[model samples]
Target: MKSITRYLVINISIWALLAALSAGVILTSLFRTSAEDAFDGQLDMVLKMLVGELATQLFSSEELSRPGSLGQPRFELPLSGWYWTVSRSNKDELVFASLSLGGENLTVESQSEKQYTGGIGRYLMGKGPDGKRIRILEREISFGPDQSYYFRVTGNAAELDEQIRSFENRAWLLMVLFGVVLLTASLLLVRTALRPLTKLQRRVRDVAIGKSEAIVGSYPVEVDGLVEEANILISSNKETLERARTQLGNLAHALKTPLSVITNEVRSSDLQNADMLVQQVDVMRDQIQLYLDRARFAARHNTIGTVTKADPVLKKLTGVMSKIHPEKMVDYECSADSDICFRGEEQDLEEMIGNLVDNACKWASSRVVVSLTEGLEEAAVKRPQKKNANVRKWLSIIVEDDGPGISEGKIDEALKRGKRLDESKPGSGLGLSIVTEIANLYQGTFSLERASLGGLRAELVLPAIKEE
Candidate 1:
């Protein structure tokens, strides 16, 4: 149930963290190798200088009791962790030592028996005097067949470690900053990349809420296919519903005439079962009409982009009502804002409003009033957290009459199918029931109360479409 953006961010963060960790480790290892190689190169240069100084001493015939300087001043400081020594290779006897050695010997443990040859030396890590770690380079030079000397130079390993540690700290800091910058850039890129999808989501929501008939917008190639598929689905659903409604209407029309014939035939006969047959045929006819009305209402329910102007439909219905019941001599008054509209099919509005007006004329003695208003209900405005909060603008149809109103306790029965308060009244008792069904299909409500004119007040509330 997680959003796409959140899922992408989580995955990207995990990968970025792992990439940072891997880069840090690799960089640390490379820096360590580079630092050790630099330290070893310094040791090699110092060892070569010492060997050359010893050759100079031998050529000048100087005594080997004291070590000669190799031009590095730190080698002269006692226990300064930089030292040089010369010894007999065969006996391991010290021939000369630097002052920094403090009269102690440097002992190196060799892992292999092979000696470095070809005028080159071997570098070793070993223990110095005072148990300090040191890097040593040892080389052997032969003055004659029986004379061989070992030249050894040592430097503190701690200095090399400190250099590597300092580089590690700065390198890791830079890598962390780089990772943060990359992740931030990635977040912005994701939002920008998915903006089309967000817009598409809004368009689809507009279709669901009856604001638009289809998804409409420009999209990236990656999402254009999805938009097309959604439009196709909407079209498919509408087509299927239309086909079902057509079939239901055809079936209703096909059955009505035959049923009417059966009822007429039974009424004309005098057989004992004629009455039973007539009653059964009449029930069948009512059921067919009821289901046909339901099929029509279902077709309108949830239909997108269906807007009906209320003023014209109401005005037309009032004119028809006067002609339909001229004997009653009922005076009709209708008032509505021209901009007030219903968010449903025109036929559905006509059906519901026509039934209410007809029912009012049937019961009214002299006067009937039909009014339309556009506003949010008191309960709807107070409880803004309701599911249909977007449908705040409601079109209210109020019909009132001055004839006798039904008792408040029997109002519920009036809405039920085939429930008639007086059998003397000329009706099938399905008028209010059909109105209620149609109102419910449009996600509206139908209610009855005491009219201001002393008859019944029939109020219908339906979602309204704004003029714009």
Candidate 2:
């Protein structure tokens, strides 16, 4: 069976991991983009400084290198990966350059750097004169109407790469940690959410197997509605059965007196076939009795649940039977646990055992052996894969003797109602039928097989319970 808690936990964990990974990707991208935009903004400021602050200084200088500090001092150091240059537009002629250029002209791989221009100022990534990766910002500036020069400012791209790489590593690490926390939280929440459901299932199963009358204890508000509905359903079912039993009893009372009146009137009257009428009336009474017996057994099998100790019952029955059949040596053996019990009314258990023992004593030549043993039913042998779930218990009773046993082919036939193999037995052949009917009511089995004691073996298996 699929577990609800396991299903919920697994699905929640999968979604949590997916969401965390997607968040990591998106967060890292945004961080890197913000850092890159800030880095480009600083470079753009320096480009403005070169155009506004040093435009006149460069135009009047003959050597095109007289500068103390243009924007930052790093541009004055040779091969510092920060430089600036002014060149004639529409030509590759350098007019003025920063000191950090080291006498080498500034040029881009394409018509510009590794990237293209968009608006007034263009951003590009390219190799600088120092053989280091740099970001270049280029723009064509006109000091007058005709004279135009290209201004380019360069900065180190390696710094931006390092900062973005560091942020990516940290972001992925945080995402992984958050995913673990999320999965852990999901596991706890799933178990907590399902705890009440698990308890309710056990209670329902216990009620089904006659361990409890109905669900017990308080629960969360979310589960209280389900508990109420379940209790209602269980109570309604038992009530319906009880009402049906009451109605059937009322019907019996309504019919029984009338039936008795007809039988008595027919007998007292001088009818042509008075004996025949009495016999038919007797049969009708027998039929009604049989119907009521079936109805009673039907009501009992679904009883809320009761426990009856078997040891005392077995001891009492065997003692009574020894005196009832003094000529026959009737006995009993119990290999079952001391605490083993029947999961039904004491009378039902007595009824099934009494029929078997009585029949055994009737037919046994000398001795009879009645034994009880712990046994597992064929259907309940395989256990359910659940925790705290009840496993049904069962027991077997075998009654055998030394008398002549019936044939194997007649075993099934003998269980039929009114199937008297030998009329000389002085019975209506309803003992085994009654036993079978009651056994079936408890969802039990009754069979006749050759006993090891050289006689018929009546093996009855019924639902049982432990004392605890």
Candidate 3:
């Protein structure tokens, strides 16, 4: 699944793009309208000025064949796309024209009375003498009888088009720049807004890895309730597991006492069935012990903030093993990294390491070796120099002895619960089995192999806490 930050960023970016597009469209439209309006205003002024000039000539009885200049140089240049015309309304004949027309006429449409205002003129889009698009403004006026004329002024539509196109280009560029700024600001805002959540996530990881006991730090009011609830949930789960472990211990004690009594009673009896009853009782006791061990491991395996240093645990276990097997004349060798720690309950670590070291002591003729090291599988095999905390690492606890090691075929059988080989040896065959079960509960691995010491090698790989 995608993270919340990515989901929110994508959604916000999409909306921002949509809003920018909408703004661009609106701005482009307004720019075009304003450009056209400015063009029409220029044509209106020219048309009114031409009408006043023509009226002055008519009232003064001046026989002017051409209209005077309207103070715009383009009007005097031929095919310059700026032109004016004065024509008789009755005969539809051109009476006067600007020099810029170059002897070609401007196309004028017939206008209705309602189309023209009393003082204001009518504006239109039309073709000029040079066949270019143009804006035209026309007005009709009368000085006397047989003196009515239409005055029309036109400007090139291309200029207005160029101006609008230039405005659109700049407008779009600005909008794109604005969009980029907006998106950058939004991303920064999102990161800042979610910083508290990121802190919460790191604290939760710390709790899981036994670096801290509970969630800590101030959070936003919006997520403060969630933080409190998570702390409550952690406390509740710990309490529940503690209660369950206590109940399981009580149950195991209660059952074992009665089972022990039954076993003793059967042993004292002389009947033929008594031996069979004793055997069955012993089997029941073994089964109870196995299951009780499993129950304890299962209850404590996932407890948060539980850490055990391997050096102290290994030292203590090896010391106990040395005392237990003093007559074996075993020379015990033990070494462990002080910084290495197990991310689990201390008793569980004791149980697993104790079983392996005890088994090595039991079988060793003269020497037993126990070693603890932190390693990644890939690094252990190939690159031992590089260390990556994000990669999975294991705490390898290896016990090797100089006694007779089992063949590869029987190693699997040896790990099975209650499957004792060489019954002459005083053991219920649950040692390796219990170690295997605890390793499995911790999401670890166990293997048996030929030892460097010329006997059995029992190796355990359990999850290790990464160094900060």
Candidate 4:
């Protein structure tokens, strides 16, 4: 499953980027459109006002050189394109000028003959000898009979265009900042909302590996029913498995005595084919018993899913071995915490550990060392103390002997059911096979390696059970 943090971050990033792009497009378009409309309206009013001013000169028939008359017209200071002039229609000359031009010649276009309505005009703007870009409006107004005059008005648009561009830049900056903040907030919201789900997932994993009895944390309403149902299923399955194993074990024990009596009677028979028949029946019975043992091992349970101390199990096995093989001395050693414990069925644990320790005693000349530690190997011995049954923390039980070890190539096949290196060696190869089955029951693992004592080592590691 994907991690929640990464999932939320990716979704939030995409949404934030899209939102920023959308806001930028919309805000820029609106501001530019609104500013253009406002400027266009102002341009129209300036055109009309300039036309009225020029009409006065044409109606009075004033001298072309007279100050504040037809020759020189006063205008508002800081004039942009708000300028006017009255000129003779025939000569195409300027009859009067305005301070809005500051004595500069006006190169107005004469498009009046083509079309004479409100339209765009290009002309120089400002009062300097040099001019800048501006839009001009031109129209013909009649002052009196045979006294028609040309009126032109213009305004500087450079500053207004700069202002609009500046506004656009600010808008984009604000959108980027908002997008970042929105993305951060969105990620946090996602993480907080999914926190319970994360916990549920972890609890489920613990149950799957037999580390937890059930989900223990609070859940949101959306998932509470699901959790309850899962807990019920886990409980039911464990109970059913245990019941099946117990019945299988009882059946195996019930048949063992009958099978042994038949084998003893067949062995004493004098008939030629009777010995072969007896051996065959004995083998068949052993196979049935091995499977029965496996079933019994699988059915056991860890009570309340609590951890059982590893040192105690190891010490108990060593003590039992001393009595079982009184001639051999079994040593118990531990390198892990005395508090170290694991989640496992008690019977299965004893079965697996018993097999390993018993085999070590059978083969060892004198000393058999057993160590129960919490780690995968000697190098990994030092680790954090926090225990979790379904995860990395491991409770390793290692049993080593100083007897001759099995050949390297046969180790893998040795764990197979009914397979033994030495048929003459007492007891069925079923011991190792039973150990393997028991290890699997609790989700534990086992390996046979060369021991430090130059013999065989059975290394078993199981997940540590978590405390309630």
lDDT of 1 by residue, 172-205 (tens): 9988997898799889999999999899988986
RMSD of each: 7.6, 5.4, 5.6, 6.0
Pairs with backbone N, CA or C atoms under 3 Å apart (clashes), candidate 1: none
Distance from true location, Cα of 250 in model 1, Å: 5.0
lDDT of 1: 0.83
Please give the lDDT score at residue 261 for candidate 4: 86
Q: What is candidate 4's lDDT per residue for 4-52, written digit by digit as tens?
A: 6787788789989999999999999999878865765665566565565
lDDT of each: 0.83, 0.78, 0.82, 0.69
Off by over 4 Å in 3: 55-62, 71-73, 77-80, 87-94, 101-152, 269-272, 314-340, 360-408, 424-426, 447-461
Clash tally, candidates in order: 0, 0, 0, 2
Which residue pairs in model 2 clash with each other? Answer: none
Weakest ten-residue segment in model 1 by summed lDDT: 378-387
Query: What lDDT does model 4 reach?
Result: 0.69
Better of 1 and 3 by TM-score: 3
Ranking by lDDT: 1, 3, 2, 4
TM-score of each: 0.64, 0.73, 0.77, 0.75
